[model samples]
Target chain A: MIIGQIKDGIVLDHITAGKSPEIYQILCLDKLDCTIATIQNAESLKMGRKDIIKIGKVIDINFDVLGYIDPGITVNVIRDGKLAKRERLTLPERVTDIIKCKNPRCISSVEQELRQEFRLADRERKIYRCIYCDSEAKKQI
Target chain B: MRHLIDIQQLSREDISRLIETALDIIENPGRYSEVCRHKKLATLFFEPSTRTRLSFEAAMYELGGDVLGFSESNSSSAAKGESVSDTARTVGCYADIIAMRHPKEGAPLVASRTAGVPVINAGDGGHNHPTQTLADLLTIYREKGSFNNLTIGCCGDLKFGRTVHSLISAMSRYENVKFVLISPEELKVPKYIKTDVLEANNIPYIESTSLEDNIGKLDILYMTRVQRERFFNEADYLRLKDSYVLTPEKLKAAKADLSVMHPLPRVNEISVAVDDDPRACYFKQVLNGKYMRMALILKLLEVAV
Candidate 1:
């Protein structure tokens, strides 16, 4: 397990192992942020195995992406080399911005400029419904 | 709901709400112009369907939203090796909604899993066409005035007709709804329709190889095509194709109020002369498709509202 702490930034710990790339892409952190360290297959007490990404800035994070990518991730705001804020991510009750839907033919997939929106219909299964075309995604199955 | 995969998932009340919404849009079109203002609808049609695709875009346009997306598979990224899920995830980032039609079974289902936006299955391979089902329901309500105590004659290809199957499944929910399955012996209604929809549900129905023989008995004549490609041999196609044609002369044998319907882009299955007949409701069905879709959009949005 590769373990290294960030000098001055937020640490995203307890992400589901092997889901780092999806998190990286969804957050759009490839361009603006610097000194980002991504570690996978790290052992954790909470999650038998985990992934962690430490970012070196206070840039606004999209809690939605964190909620969607991995609900198990613990977002810790680090200030002056000390942990400032720590909380487990919770998926939003209603998603105003959807990243995907169960329907392949939805306009959002074809167009280059629309934001996907969904309502969390069944929280336990993570079932989401698209507002535009009314497609359902059953996350559990 | 991002993807409409199957009609079995929707309740009867859900179907009614969709139909009522479509009727409202038909009755008052202007009221929904700006309902989807600043929004966009993307249509990804892998198969060629000029009518169905247009109806979906029209539904969005009527709601004051703009439309974008491809009408054919060759014109889009599908020609490349991009997986449906990969393409869907990328597009979900851009569009607010998506409606897809593919020749492969469960293509839209795969899209729904990966898409970040809402997805509508326009039609899948001989599977489901829920939107078209809604159009049929609205057409029945508008033309026949009610769905109860009616006999529907489903004429033409039964084995491969998605519309026919969907219509039968929907009408089975109404009271005293009987089906007159009309087609050549070679093109008879599938056994699944008999065992699954009619028999399982105990809906009254009969199968026949004659169209005009029972034309006068039906309240609605539902016409479908006998595709030459669906036949195994050229001789079989030649033998069965003419068996289902609905000519104007045959109209005289039908009830005066007997409505004729076709989920159409008719290629001789229904004669052109029949278009001018008062009983013809196929063209009106096209108009009803747009209205029904508008109703669906409004209802889904209201859930979000």
Candidate 2:
């Protein structure tokens, strides 16, 4: 399978197998006018199989969402067909407007304008709790 | 700038100071009567609460501070679709401090961020009620003379009981404190509280269904009513509401020196016959709540004695 590289764009590499669709949906990649390609089940030495997403244009990405979804994924910035930056993500201590608090009794449920915020409650377990209700975020990913 | 959003926000030293101040208020009421002559407290209760709202109002009044604000959402601008932040900002302009109780969790936190004055979370859904923990602390301190080396048996609804969670969190900080959590299987304490709080602190605790079985070993028997408002299903509320009632028969197994406590507006979780059991300290807890609130109000206002 031959896929063309982009001159100025982002390559989300080393994503866990079968997780790019969620990343794409959450990041709202469909709204972007630029070309995007998702290469699934690619052979890798580090991980037996991995997913790669290639964005054809340089666009802002929410690293917190990426970190929360899969911290193992690597973000590479391509500028003038050269790897400008290679970045690794870690779980954010706090996240805002990324995930909604599902607790029905949460104040954010009724107040539409309030930013959905979560704090990393446990680092080892990758547990995030709603800032308002303290309800644990469901394991959607 | 300080707000009492969660009991965890308060350190052990802070709780000790608050308890000391509360005790001092109880001992020498006249000395602190006129401490806040010009200050105003706004009780912004977005939900119906008999004890907490009145307790804040009474606390402010006792300190020579005027009290204002609404009893429920209908009477306040919240009924007109005003956000908690807006209501808090508006209320902050009139009052020196705000004590808020809302049905939605973390409403007071939102208010605390926007309300220019300090905010006290009276109650926010089933999330937190720090002042109630203060009252409980004062009662426990007065009864047992210390928070250390005590066996606290929390009975009834441990799941949605914010007071129990707060009390557990507060008391767990002390030395040699143990807990006997008595609740139905469906109403057991949340897993995070057990794992994050109790286990994380190396605090020893046990879960049980029978109150009578564990009542004998307790230094303090904290009873909580299964709050109907917390339930989404009426059938579940009805089934669980009467799970553990503290009758005199059950009290017979309890220690003679056991301090029986409850956060009130209780609905038959405790029998009326047990009210005169001499060890019943629920009424005292109510009075202690006012003193604690007064102390808290003074603390937040930076009022020096």
Candidate 3:
């Protein structure tokens, strides 16, 4: 059963289970004044398992952060308890100002004060590359 | 431009512009010093590549920029089981731009996605080395005065040398080029390269195990180290490692103007006796690398910021 509802906010659907912490971090939800419900490990007839993040207020989505966390997450804007707009946040052509390059020797990673930037060249392959240090966003732990 | 993940994103016009910028830096070093002044470059090297690491730092320093980041993997938080993405998110808060080198394939690509700053791939496992290829292009342009219609003979470990593979892919795009792949039977150029690059494009080429036999007919002699570790048996390695060395006697057979190039950090592939020869361009290659790097830093920073 659909438990209750959000009056006015954004609903992030189709998130992988147990990824709310990262999604929360990506959206900077903790720092904001809003209600966030992260549902993980739920049974779905369509999807074997699913996750969702329901926000109580409308916040301008940070697409770079969203794309990085899970390229598959979709953000839906709810207005007056009606779905105003729902679309998958396509990865940007060039991702800028959302992530810090982890290449310890990368010029951006080494210099403590400098802000790291990477361009999202391809979304399907989930490839993001650094402009200065030439480091790529590697998903491998 | 947040990340420079692949060379495919760059058009030929882009590469030409970069080379032109590099040439400008070589001609006037003082003009571009402050271009990146006060900016910091973070270098995250998870692997040990002394030459590449130093070359990158030198590039940033020459631009009046400061350098930060680690040279070793052990010193970083990654040792404690921090994920590459999480580490990148944290590091992104600190650095303006980042360069990463990891032993794992596609590590840089992963870091690039998570980084807020510009990312440069120094070397990611053996998948791609675009910057080194850029340096090679700059070196060829500066040394040969052009990038067209010339024979490039790559000798040594063709199968494993990342430099050789990148150069071949880059050079194959040029006009009127032929390749002389010189390596032992045990260390032939990979079949994929020959099929995908040479024959597919109909670029004329020949392969041989004897460097001396092919030395006289080439315009460029590219040497790569034939490591003992690549061989299964010690006797075979001992037998073939010395077979391809460029000796003074071998140079006698080469053309008077035949240029000899090595990717560097040489380990007896090219004799010390050949160092004094005018044909040896490896030392010049090193300096050219610095100049080219200076050019790259200037161009990338200018375009992005």
Candidate 4:
């Protein structure tokens, strides 16, 4: 599939297959007034199969959400149809507004304006927990 | 400490030190009477938590400090839709330190961030009850002599009890502490605590629906009331309350040295007859709460400046 190349935007590459929609939905990429294409089961030299999301305009992204969903994902920034920079994500120590605290009594639930935050409790297990209640925070995306 | 939000943040050594400090104050109350003469503790309760709030106020008072603030959400600016951050920032101007108990978890954390002083979480929803856990640790050390190699039976509402959660997390930091989780399947310990705190820490633990089976081997029998507030149905609370009641008959099966503890305001979880039992230490837990609060206030105010 010719998903097209980014001229001046972000290319979210190496997304675990079948997770691009979640990233797209989470980032609200479809609502942006710019060209965005998602190619599923894309050919990869490193990964046997991957998902790629190409945005045709420069826009801000929530890296914490992207990292939480799949830490192995890579991003390449294009400027003037040239690869400006390449970025790879790792699990962050703490993230805000990436995951919701599942515990019913968590402050993030009652205090609507407060950011939903989580911390990587166990890096090996890829376990993130609500910063407030310490409950395990599942990635809805 | 800038914030006493979680018992998990406190090491066994820090707990021991605080317990020792509490004990020291207990022995010679006159020595530290005026330790916090000019200090003030703001008891900001956005929930109806009289016991915890009273314990905090009593602690501040006994330490020669002043106390201030509202007891319920309706009484405060929160009733007028004021945010916790705004209230905390406003309260910070009037009080030197804060002891907050909110129905929402991490409300104290928000206070700690903006309060411009140390914040003690009296009890924040079901997230934590660090002060109560401090009282429990002190009581356990006094009764069991050591936290190591002891079988602690945590009975009742483990799922919703912040005291049980904090106590388990705190005691797990000790050497060779085993947890006998005695509760109905519906009230089993939360998964995160089981997996993250207990399993991850490699602490030995076993779960059983029968409290009597585990009572015989326990060094500490921590009884918690099955809160009516936690149940969606009144019948469920009524049915489950009888399942965990600690009576003299049950105590007969327990070790003679077993320390029976409860965070008070008991809604018939323990038999009133058990109050006379030698193993009963729930009343002492009340006094310990006072002393621990005193120790906490002194520690916070000592470094407040």
Give a tens-digit lDDT track for model 2, residues A7-47.
99999999999999999998899999999999999999999
Model 3: native contacts recovered, as a fraction: 0.00
Off by over 4 Å in 3: A1-141, B6-9, B227-243, B303-305
Tens-place lDDT per residue, model 1, B1-305, is: 54466665567888777777777676777777788998777888988889999999988998998888897888888898566777788888888888888875456766887887777878875656778877888888988788899999999888667788888988898899999998777677666567657987899898888887889999999999876644458997777776667888888898999989998878888999999999999988898888887776666545321
**Model 3 lDDT tens row, B46-155:** 87778888988998888889899898889988777676666777788887778888765456667877787778878765446667777878878877887787899999
Off by over 4 Å in 4: A1-9, A28-37, A56-58, A79-83, B303-305
lDDT of 4 by residue, B1-305 (tens): 46788877677677777888999988988887777888889999888886788888888888788999999899999998888888888998999999888988788887788888888888888778999998888888788778899888899999889899999888888889899999998888998889888998899999999987789988889999887776778988887876688889888998888899998889788999999998999998888988888887767666331
Ranking by TM-score: 2, 4, 1, 3
Interface CA RMSD, all predictions: 9.3, 0.9, 9.4, 1.4
Q: lDDT scores for all predictions?
A: 0.78, 0.92, 0.76, 0.85
lDDT of 4 at B270: 92
Considering TM-score, which of the candidate structures 2 and 4 is the better prediction for this target?
A: 2
Q: What is the interface RMSD, in angstroms, for predicted model 1?
A: 9.3
DockQ of 3: 0.03
For residue A87, model 4's alpha carbon misses the true position, in angstroms, by 2.1
The regions of model 2 sitting more than 4 angstroms off are A1-6, A31-35
lDDT of 1 by residue, A26-141 (tens): 77779864788888888888778888888888678878767866777889998888898998988776676545665544545654444667766556766566654445654521
**Tens-digit per-residue lDDT, A49-129, candidate 4:** 899889988788877778888899888999999999888999889988777777777777767488878889889989888
